[model samples]
Target chain A: MSATVYIPREATALSLGAQSVARALAEEAARRQDAVQIVRTGSRGLFWLEPMLEVATSAARVAYGPVQAADVAGLFEAGFLTGGKHRLNLGPVESIPYLKNQERLTCGRLGVIDPVNLDDYRAHGGYAGLTNALAMEPAAIVKAVTDSGLRGRGGAAFPTGIKWKTVHDAPGAKKYIVCNADEGDSGTFSDRLLMEGDPFCLIEGMTIAGLAVGATSGYVYLRCEYPHAQDTMTQAIATAYAAGYLGADVLGSGRAFELQLRMGAGAYICGEETSLLESLEGRRGQIRFKPPLPALKGLFGCPTVVNNVISFASVPIILERGAQFYKDYGMGRSRGSLPIQLAGNIARGGLVERAFGVTLRELLYDYGGGTRSGRPIRAVQVGGPLGAYWPESKFDTPVDYEAFAGGGGMLGHGGIVVFDDTVDMAAQARYAMEFCAIESCGKCTPCRIGSTRGVEVIDRLVAGDRTAMQQTLLRDLCDTMLNGSLCALGGLTPYPVLSALDYFPEDFSTPAALQAAKR
Target chain B: MSERKRVTIPIRVEPGTDLPAAERTAVLEAVNQNRALEGSLLPILHAIQDRLGWIPPRTLPLIAYELNLTRAEVHGVVTFYHYFRQHPPGKQVIYLCRAEACQAVGAVSLEAHAKRALGIDFHGTSGDGRYTLEPVYCLGNCASGPSLMIDRELYGRMTPERFDDLIAADAAGATSAAATSAGATRA
Candidate 1:
């Protein structure tokens, strides 16, 4: 093993020339006779200062960067590798305000370790949760998860513990734990970051689930678009098997659990658990009827606990820190920290993990530092494309499921996409319907047909259909889709559409004068 | 040239192409592994695509035979997803984001210009076997919209000027045609 330096430069970091900086460091190290290995790790979510470099030493690793290749020799001469003072004065990385106050549970080990290093993973509290669970009865493990108050982070906000408990209690000869890594939401890549940045967290999370639910197998249904994440996870799983964390009788425990990754073909609807389940089973990704939920009859007609990447990723922390420790942070029933992705027209657009109920106003103005365009933030699209568009007046809406629902929006995946004053809400509303139309699996009439028709209606409305009759028809279609659709795809597509109509009525007012030409 | 009409490539199975016996078994096992999960046919098709870059025209019969469906039924699943391609790809895959966010940031103009420059539409492989163009939606790095992913490397804030420079750099870096072709087929 040689003295190595790791750069926490994700794709976001690469966009800022982190690769060149890494190469520069490698060259400088090479000139010194001693070899230096530059391992590219995931971003620390402090995306503002990417190309963040950490140099290994006997003590704590010293960090230096957002440094360019141009300054490599100067950095080396200044003894920056040993954490000497420099112009970048980030001052002992742990002291950085954005990172210091963060309640990092899911992202605890994100940028600290080499993504593929199984040994590094073990050194940093990686498999402790699995180790703890391996010592207990499966039912006891399920109870611990239940008490943690961890909800699904993949939009739905379903209780993770209850879902697992149901699978544990359900009568089935075979059971499964599926990680819904098909994170297709436009403004979200937390799942991708976790899988690529820290693959072991997901492995530990899945292993714990397998032990709790009496399941012998787990599958991570990753998106095809994230080929890097898929490859990272595949390598990690192989390493884990070699280390005895996966595949038959894990860690000397009598429990048998095998983990696999199933790649999704880039369909947005497959993010829906049932569709994901269907896709995993070699079928078209159409939503299934509830009632006979996956808890009862899932993969191969056995009880399966399906959850988003973050939900399971939160497991180790819950187990290690105990239920009350995990639950103590949040306000009200929305217990625990959420990995909120602040994206779109925002200055500091990256992951902001905070306790639940950190109101949108604070998150937008205080944390995000307002619009990146220097224009007034006109609107914010919280959640994915299907989420509602909330204007400035609703910014006070607390970042919790219930509060968001009361404000005519759902806290789908905690992905807050800000939009500046230059945005046309009418156009945004149309795109929402258009997105739904494109992604609907055509399994049900309401989603497949309603989405296409919704696009047409939105177009008509945009075309200056100034009559009250047209507005009424649009509202009625929204209501019908919300009530009749089988899944969130069709049901929530109207949220953005109707929210736009409600908040920005001026967008609907195309005068009859220029309407003909505009249309 | 006039705007090229989009062709929905039909799925077919081919028997030729020097696939080893182990690889053939691996492909069949991939189909079986996915089918055993949820009894869904689409996942199985996606699994095949994941392992093999594009759905080989010959694998449809193998998939069809396993799933107890005709060739057409299997074909439908492969074509439905924009991620799936019927033809074998070229050397370097250039995936340009054409979603709403990217379009809002001028991806539309960039995409059109790129296609014109390369003489290929989305899913079209350049005649020189250097690059294949693909259209993707949002890549989740929207703060720096108008992005492209070239062989697992995400390039953001992509402008026409930078795009030209990237192509030139890639041409200069080409050590071998065979290696470049392999890189183009994936990502």
Candidate 2:
């Protein structure tokens, strides 16, 4: 009998040499005439242990990893095919502390099943939510989502149920469900992970949204950067259509729900809901003024339920288990598990899914195991580029939306990028302004002009010219961009700048001090 | 830097210069495949770029004419997007991640090393027309910092040595193709 060996085909794992490892395994098996079958699955989110190969034993799946192609010959020589002893062997993947400790509601099936196989997905409890949602009334479905306390996982923290109910009640003959898969935020890959690892969950979630609202059509506005994800999703969509999970009638319910995938051409602003809608309509991605919410007037001038990829992907679980069962996991107003991506300069950087109350200190030290460079951790940036640079002092803040917001930070896409003591806060601040300047949709002046000026001001400060005055001017410029901008692109650029100035004033002042001392 | 502010600076095309017959026919076919869909402009632009190497200056008018849109509108979109190349690209394109996550773990140094090695800045093609360097905001491989992409294949945890090897391999492939073509010419 042939034993099945699991190798991750996800982008991150592939980048870290999973493809070469898979090839080596195949070649070695053929050379030895060994009966071994290789199956490509998604990463278990333990990125540091990538090329993490698994062998299915009668009892459990044995694991080995951070494996390279060069190590394959040695692994085979050590009789690793039937889970023999090797230096890389991590017995029974479920026993690994990094993955075992956390709650994985949304990502339960990630890295577990073959992403494109319909039967594998169903066996692991994939469409149970859609099945349950199919039996309920639209209002009941909306009420269930609301009762579960699910909010937009895309940083906004807006209640998902309320958004659905608005679209459900809105008087529109045609409505649309648009999944915001344009995850342009740096250090964030939960959306990409979900889309690539288990695309059926996203499809099921969107279908539930389509049924909840009267929307007959859905679109996933995915960014072009994710070519692998695009291929995976496209294949998954085709599979769903073949299985009658999509197209003219979903699960033979006699209701039509059509889904299409559209690619965005390298625009960061399009991650915003309105801008995404504009890009979907085949126009430049520029932020539109709010007041007429997308739930009221959206894509093609119809009510639209524009939710993030994670938000939609989280829906299946809410329906599969009752709302109360899911809601019981989280703290405060923030309900359910938040998939936090630990990235950049961290020892064990990967996806960590836990209930909302997990502290930054716990996530950084416990799960992350400090900086990869082994340097003293100085600061961490929660969220993306637009999020604040949190000093060590603020590490106690919980992962909840309100807790983060109260501490002058955001849980934007729940991406945390750690920086060691070697980091220069001033340069990071300058980068924040520079990023805003580059990606700003030219529609708003404060974002357009203010960001450019902010870059110049930071440059002047860095060059040791009139530091005190520039610091004050930088704050004022941030205020203007904060209050006058149309969207978060302009409004949130100040978070990093102001936080840098406030948290690490010494770095900004050192240049001036050095200049004065030299004089 | 001053040139960056302009939304649409019209490309200078010599008078009476048209796209080659085969390329023109391919563009028309690509446009026809998507013209019936609502908001077909972006997809049409993508198709043209896919069919041809890049969106030619002469083809914008052709696209506008077929899609019932103005030439200015088509020009605006091509310029607005960073992905759409204004000119034909080299044999391979490399997109380096320049976002904050990458920078946190040595992307800045990688960018400098890549620029020095390639002998071209961002958006510049190599002198031998073998490579084009571009900057992408993020590639969603932030867990492994200092990520880059050649064509569509992503590479991460890159060092200067590894980068040099990758470029060398690509150059070797280009040389072999050139050699084959030269042999074909002799035959």
Q: lDDT tens digits, residues A320-413, model 2? A: 9889988998889999999999988999999999999999999999999998889988999998989999999899999999999999999989
Query: What is the TM-score of each predicted model, taking all chains together?
Result: 0.89, 0.95
Candidate maximizing DockQ: 2
List DockQ, one per candidate, in order. Answer: 0.25, 0.32
| A410-462: candidate 1 lDDT, tens digit per residue | 88888788888878888888888888888998887878888888888877777
Candidate 2 clashing pairs, residues 3+ apart or interchain: none
RMSD (Å) of each candidate, 1 decimal: 6.8, 6.3
State which docking tier applies to candidate 2. acceptable
Best by lDDT: 2
lDDT, model 1? 0.79
Cα lDDT for residue B88, candidate 2? 84
- Candidate 1, superposed: residue stretches over 4 Å from native: A1-4, A34-37, A56-62, A465-467, A511-519, B1-53, B56-59, B66-68, B87-91, B99-132, B171-187
Q: What does TM-score give for chain A of every model?
A: 0.95, 0.99
Q: Where's the lowest-lDDT run of ten residues in candidate 1 chain A?
A: A510-519
